[model samples]
Target: MASAAEQLAANMNFQAFAKATELHKRIWFTLIAMVVYRLGCFIPIPGIDIAAFSQAFQGQAGGILGMFNMFSGGAVERMAVFALNVMPYISASIIVQLLGSIYPPWEKLRKEGGEAGRKQLNQYTRYLTVVLALFQSFGIAVSLSSSPGIVDNPGPFFIISTVVILTGGTMFLMWLGEQITSRGVGNGVSLIIFAGIVAVLPRYVIQAFELTRTGGMNGGVLFMIVVLAVAVTVAIVFMERSQRRLLVQYPKRQVGNRMFGGDTSFLPLKINTSGVIPPIFASSLLLLPATVMGFAASGNLPAWAESWLPGMVGQLQHGQPLFMVLYGALIVFFCFFYTSVVFNPEDTAENLRKYGGFLPGIRPGKRTAEYLDYVLTRLTVIGAAYIAAVCLLPEALIGFAGVQFYLGGTSILIVVSVTMDTVTQIQSHLLAHQYEGLIKKSKLRGGRGR
Candidate 1:
């Protein structure tokens, strides 16, 4: 049976994908959804003065807003209705996940119920997104209006309008993401972000050339950067795919009258089980305060407040020592935090014991749980360090290289991880299709032989 399955997979080809009508439809639907997302990013919000807003962003592009703008695919810079993107939703989801670890009610909901609980949690996340979106939009609007020469006049009406519009835009984006997830191939949120990042590539390239023309960057540095980027991308791919396999042995057991069971399997744990969450969480937390500070600096504030606040803000700015330290620490913290949230050794051990599975050299209950936990702790440390290096090294290099582009660690990790997952899904679909074809062929051959 295994040999036949292998033969089926070996024969799988592009023609199978073409013949699979449902897969084709799914692919097309995903493409259309992405196009819709891109279109939303181009639609400007009602209140913003485009010319003035553009100028303001141009100056503040090196700040926290710059990072946000990149994530939104230049929507923030263009003052688009979807300028906030789905980040508030992501932030809300992360917050809920974190809280679920500590809060008993949330923890119970997570462990006890299945689909119903998940749906309830999702509903809560959406509510949190709406609230966060409103707050952030209000803050952004107030800040934009406060910026000198950016707005014609600042008033309660304008602030209220901006907040409402931005919040509505975010909700719309959230809905769009859900549609993509239900109908599309990859994750809707990640694809939206991926689209945004890809959209700005041409601009980043153009800017790089402009820098070269202006002698801001030399050809040697440019070559080095390209090489490093490629190498880092390769490393990300490798680490993301790497896994540790824990061998599990099942003892023979008699059920009714027959013997059923001496079998072996393996528990696979990914090296970077947390994926891109750690870096993203770290970035969001680090950027929040800097964003607030940048906005405050735009406003007319007391001199004393401005003097002290700017120093505090400066510490959190990208490329600064304090920023790097905080970012690294946050990444490590989230690595462990997210890992624990996702993987429970006790639960795993329980499931294994229920299935009559045990680690080759370990006992089946508490000892098995403890062994798994010990291994996971060591693995988490390695995973955290790997994440930190991948994320921080690029930023450090980009800082030293003085590149004008905003390619950061989080963006690269997302692109790599999502791409890998999508590819694996595609391959699995193809393999299944191939096996079905093989089974049909084998049946036909058997009938002829009879």
Candidate 2:
């Protein structure tokens, strides 16, 4: 039998949506924000020769540049203002979060302090974003200048301008994302990325068809790719939704003449508590090598150094054994690292003990914490393997088929996860709207009875 909430959700229709005026506003705001983001992807920064840059980019397109372009919705390909995207912000956030776990001051602020502390940490993240953006944009500027004819003026002026424009563009995107999170539906940063990936999806699909028409790819391979994509997506959804429920019991107690407590509940822990962070962090680290090599290739290096750079880049190329091994290892490492950062079994156990709750077969406090940790460790191991498999499969397909579709495993994960989350938020709003209508009806009935 369907629960009341489930039945109510099933019965929801256009009428309820039409009544959700706030949801409409949020949806509109999100659309407009995404439009603005897409527009920025085309707004090229000053001092770049488009033709020369395009030619140079084509050579490096199969490497890090290609991945970044996919994430930025072709912003990097166009040498647009948003070419940097929100990567600097993401890097800064990761650093801050890692510090919050190990650094004493940050740890205290994160746990002991509340909203104000969160705001402070956000400010710190923004400041660090500016620094990283400046550094990365400067390096990119130098790299562009090194490429023959890529920069109109290969001087200090051009470099400064590129750095400033790119940095400013990134900061603007960060601000835009914050606004969307506050005033619209879904996570601002993630939605920005989501919008970027989805915008380019149609073009990739068309490219696949074009490849088939030109006999560039075998038809059977394409079919297999499609099937594999579907299978992986299904697996992602299932694993993401899977959780372990731990039963907790509260002993009956008496307060005054009334009985209280004596409740039974289950504490739900997701199999993949780290979500997409592990894969994102892993990819970012793996891609860093390509970016570094680009800078080195552009520089005047010794003969030995020049010879070694090519081999290093080749070894780190997508689908190579070394690349896959490192990618999977990093994913596994981050899975456990991030899971520990986000969830403290000791804290949870302490909270449960304070509330007079205990696990069915385990004592409260230390024993409970140990039990939770043991279960979580096992789940993380499984989750790490799942994430590694999903992410690496696309790399293998790309290598085997010699087709470059930007909708890789990471892209699919982000798209599906964000879409699910947004849909859930919409349903919650619709449920709230129904509850409000019920309250109004009940109030009128009570007044009539009086």
Best candidate, lDDT: 2
TM-score of 1: 0.93
TM-score of each: 0.93, 0.95
What stretches of model 2 exceed 4 Å from their correct place?
1-4, 404-406
lDDT of candidates 1 onward, in order: 0.82, 0.86
Instruction: Name the weakest run of 10 consecutive residues (lDDT summed) in model 1.
Output: 312-321
Query: lDDT value for candidate 2?
Result: 0.86
* Best of the candidates, TM-score: 2
Local accuracy of candidate 2 as per-residue lDDT tens digits, 33-103: 99999999998988888888888777677775677788889898899999989988888888898899899
**What lDDT tens digits, residue by residue, belong to model 1 across residues 1-450?**
466667766766778778767677777888888788788888887766789889877766876567778878889988888888888988898899988878889988888868888898899999999999998998888887766676666778878888988899889889988987777677778778778877886787788778888998898877776777788789899988888999999999899999999998889988888888787777677666778887776667797897787777666655667777888999999999999988999999999999999998899999999999999998889899988987788678777877766666667777788888777767776777776777899999999999
Query: For every candidate structure, what is the RMSD over all alpha carbons to the true structure, in angstroms?
Result: 2.4, 1.9
